[model samples]
Target: MNEVANPGSSAVVLIGTAEYDHADVERVPSVSANLDDLYDALLDPGIWGVPAENITVLRDERDPASVYDAIRAAARSTRDDGLFLVYYAGHGFPYDDDLVLGLREVDPQFPDEKGLRYPKIRQATQLAIALRRVVILDCCFAGRAGREVLDAGDAVKQIAGRAEISAEETYLLVAVGPNELAKAPLNDRHTAFTSALLHVLTTGSETADPVLSIRTVAEKVIRRVVAAGHRRPEFRAANAAVDAPLVRNARLRPHDLTGVVLEATADVTDPELRGAVILVLRHNDSGALGVRLNRDFGPLPAALDGWRDHVSLPDRLFDGGPVAQDGFISLVRLREHEERPIRFTEVTGLLGSLPLSDAQQSARDRIADLRIFRGYLGWRPGALERLVTHGRLRITDTNPFHAAFARAPFTRTGS
Candidate 1:
């Protein structure tokens, strides 16, 4: 699985209420349980990458002030370009040409002032500095929330379209039509809509995808829920909506190759890394460091002309991992000669590494077998290990003693 690294911070506000004061309104049996299901999904590390401190759950909050206060507090904690999601799984419906989410003490006498207004939520979401604002209204008249938020435009086709810094995306999913009743099956822990959502997350996702977007999940939920006799759920994208891949399935998690050698299996996905052998230089709790010894880019750069003939592979240079391209590294072969006036670290009796300046200081005729590398491959902690466990890599010998031109795994991307 691809590790989740958000472009910004993450904040979530989940509001659900099973208790209401109005005697005229029927209670939603699965409101609180639906929240519980979503809350559990949010806490899962294999799902959304949010830390525990970033989420807030308001269950049966009685006052509108308290609800807004908690939501604003959660929003304030998020940095710009972060994600802010608000999930409401209670009662909601069309009121005075707008939608209003019910509060714990909601009364029919004044729905506009006493209830949680959809426009207020929409306005707050639009005004928030977060880059992604998602609102999932699992209640009646949910589609009206989408109507109030989205502009009259065609929905975006591609999820990974080019991004704009000034643009913010709003993805809204409602359970029922503007005038329909939200499903609330009696004796069920969660509503049919949310239950379908859970089923999809737990089993319906396709493993081939590296990231599972909210749109994908919503579609699956809608399909299963509709097939079970519920009204068609509504999905809307406001402003510039892009795919948000927040859910993760650990069944497809990658291997962890700490301290182990990686041998590419025949089924390796990338052509560049297929049939390639690698030597694990360092794999620690912090990150992994390795180099591809097989890839040789014909001739070395003209800049390192001070002592070209001194090294065995002076004419060859390899592209390391695609990280910092400005950095240069080398692996020099050790020999039985008077050590040159340069600082070097000996890895094995026959392998050593030194600075470029030091390597250039060797005498013109001195024999210094060296391999130059531009940039270097790196994996954050367990990433390389995941690649190995995923069958993309295998373990090999640590013997640095090899041919002058060793194997290399440069030129790689999202495996």
Candidate 2:
């Protein structure tokens, strides 16, 4: 799960061209409303709730440098833990195998020279301090733009000498496939993709998850766009960012914390909890149960040493938390299509916990990953939520296993 970005520290830039000056380029009047409605959706408290002052909107702008400068300024201003989002709805075309955004005065035949090349936006995003970055494209050849922006294969040539941002932390959500044209019906108030997206963000989904995550929103919008006779949208996020929450769910109560990870904030001073990385095992009205992931408690006990081959990282038992220090919890990640092996109780996705009573019956071949911990972390009914609300324990919507290992793939300042 990926955590929602902190509103105060994040920035958003929206660019759209409703009326083109070039004779050969077609006008998309709906692009105007696309910007307006998206602005409202992003600012709504019930939705993502980004501050109005943090968003910059440029409509029918003739200067391409203004677009480039806005994105660069936003990226530079965002904090390391913040999120930066850039959205564009305009005419896009292929230029020398790259995507270019058409501005108000763009020449259809000379887009490479007259329009704004997407590499500039990508370069700006690549220099951001924000760990989570989003690019939403609503135009022709959007998929192509998304692909180039997310792909790191050409980062050296694109950025020249600047440090490259990790592609794993960036997300791309496009309105159409690489070969398809985005639908901007003259009869509709907004483009087909933007219309479906706005509907989901405003109405919320009926899914069990408490928050309307970025991936979930895309899934819901894709169905609507396809059903409405438009090209299918493409969403690409490779890491824990896939579960980043964008808004509160309007139709449901806050759900369980089975899949959530909670990282202690920088201000936390508790010796046992400060800088702790905890993975929630259960959560409900009663309380919450989790395990600390950053400590090791040496090798497994002699009686359970048989499973040592399957343990993750240092091949030792983890120091879960202060509670029930003698108890042991075994977690396993099942293979792609394997059935639920004996004693396995799923926590989320492919991860689950299994009792160690029958080692032989556990079916070793079905296991794709494993972790063992001693003790557990427990919190009273409302205590955990209060801590999170007060900023003591930051909620990170991410895969639990990422923090389970000794060293994670991405940089986690809190841990």
Candidate 3:
């Protein structure tokens, strides 16, 4: 049985730099431009389902030196409470049995000679020695980076001999096998391995094992990659005798509440809802309460969809649950200092409720123009708290920009 684990206990490092000065390997236009996308995806509050303070992201454009230092810090730190994830996306080159991750200026001809250097697998294993590490390498030849360090006899002996290990443990999940090449599909705009990995982790396709173990996530990623037209990715387990849980053990139990009503049953209709923050709504016979947020809703439009007649709200309504597919409701928050005459019920200081107007034509227009949802998330008062206590549900605090508006709804051209 999979055990529930706390997400707050971990730290994540995202390093991506594609501006290689010397190389025929077409500098992945998407890698450099989509650095923020990769960063945002990892740092997404919804992904962690935990508080912002618990997660930290180090990217190339923001701080280059700190990226390496952060990895070293994680390696040295002794925190057995949370999991640690390190994601690297860019060019990867194999050196004999070992692999080297290229930084921004890595020259294909001279990997070690040029640009910043870090032992992709060795450094990750060093960090895993102390914490539960889920190292995701999205670059080519990533599989070879950690092979040597993990296979070291001394390291294996030290971990294997231990009699008792905690449920919270460390592991690694690489994108491809050491011998195989990792390729991103042109249509998906993401590496085949990565796309499959994300799908299994978030799509709830593997819901039977909600707290995914290293073995399980690895198997799913490998299968998905191969099925998607790529070579089989590899799965390596270190210190298996330790019996550490791969994914944190947790469960997000369903909540039963009479407050709000949802409009949709399936998540397919709203592609935006996938891997996004949303507001769920539930309707009672008399009225309804729109769950302020079902997931982590991203950015809001700078201006309302159609603000000519009345100053519109800044948020877009999204499908929150699998219930009503056509019903629409919204929770609008006034600007920090700006006050309006509209009457509303306060869900929280930062969130308020506004009912759909009675006018049929106006209501239809509002629903069509704005991003409205059919259903919402319904949580009985204590149910959410219970899930949090059991490590099932995580409430994330995110900035409006980072949550929704920062990146384009669609991937940038090259990405």
Candidate 4:
């Protein structure tokens, strides 16, 4: 995922169980899907800001202590900056005035000690070196996690239902009320609650609000679930210095785009798009198009290695875009040899599109930088210019060869 513009140190711990080895715990068919969706959402380059490498996922953990240990270590690891978030989607129950996350091996009769208490989580959140600590619990009767955050002394005996805990910088979201059941309805692929969460995170709707915070997320989720006639979602925030921003809305910039010669500006938020330089093959009022310069999509197929015989650069494919993913095309950087066929359009000095026939002919001369692209990016008439006007793209002249593979398309202004 793309790091926040000024994203501080961050860590994510995700735990979910779809089945339990113990017969006492009924399998929660949707927990696995919940984890899958959440993992992707947090890694969304345009939204959650949590990097894939910085995340830890425990799926159907057989060891009861491992999740807690990992969480403890993660809390310790995040010690004073960025955000630390823990997400749990599985079986859990209220215990001794607190909610305890259930282990996969949990024995119903001995369930009391088969998990960790919410107080332990609160303690970890407090001690975590991060600026913000977020706990998301998606399980039956799981709302106590929020209530206990505000008033730990109260023995939360029933569906602790969502507590309206006040906080300076509060962040906690629970799935159902104390007596309520979090349903993974047979008709749906994901639990109603988790599906609601995903919708708020990935929706394309425009919002004047700049920041997507826990408060805002809770509100959106509540609206979605209540409208569906499911149990209401709950949220509680303790004292906080500011309402933490989870993601910044994608905005466009106002600038002219020459297509090939332009850089993505501050307003672009297309995942790994901003600051990426692209090789523009076509551009005009009718439309504009290009492929990323720096995307090295692993090594090229063995047959294509012959095309790279002349250049010392690595032979790899570049992911052009998300459009035509099933098809493949080659962007050849030829040596402009006399023996080379003139059937392709030159994109830059020595670089152009290479036909499959010539590409397979074993060029009589060496090729410099030959790249295979899975797809290409395109824009409709006047759309490319509109993007620039809204700041989605920036214009700049750069050495097509070096910029395409060696450096950041543009120097970043912030994290």
Task: Point to the candidate with the largest lDDT.
Answer: 2
Q: Could you tell me every candidate's TM-score relative to the true structure?
A: 0.59, 0.57, 0.55, 0.61
Model 3, position 147, has a per-residue lDDT of 55
Off by over 4 Å in 3: 1-4, 32-47, 58-65, 74-78, 115-121, 124-130, 148-170, 242-415
- Which scores higher on TM-score, 1 or 2? 1
Q: What is the lDDT of residue 142 in candidate 4?
A: 84
Better of 2 and 3 by lDDT: 2
Please provide, for model 1 over 306-358, each residue's C-alpha lDDT reduced to its tens digit, 9 standing for 90 to 100. Answer: 55556666556775545576877776666667664356655455465567766
Sort all candidates by lDDT, best to worst: 2, 1, 4, 3
Q: Tell how far residue 93 is off in model 4, in angstroms.
A: 1.0
After TM-score superposition, the amount by which residue 274's alpha carbon in candidate 3 deviates from its true location, in angstroms, is: 33
lDDT of 4 by residue, 334-363 (tens): 665555546766666566777645644555
Q: Give lDDT tens digits, candidate 2, residues 89-160.
A: 989888876789899999978887667898878898877788778888888888777454433324334445
> Could you tell me which 10 consecutive residues in candidate 2 have the lowest summed lDDT?
406-415
Question: Cα lDDT of all candidates, in order?
Answer: 0.68, 0.76, 0.49, 0.65
Instruction: Give the Å shift of residue 344 in candidate 4.
Output: 5.9
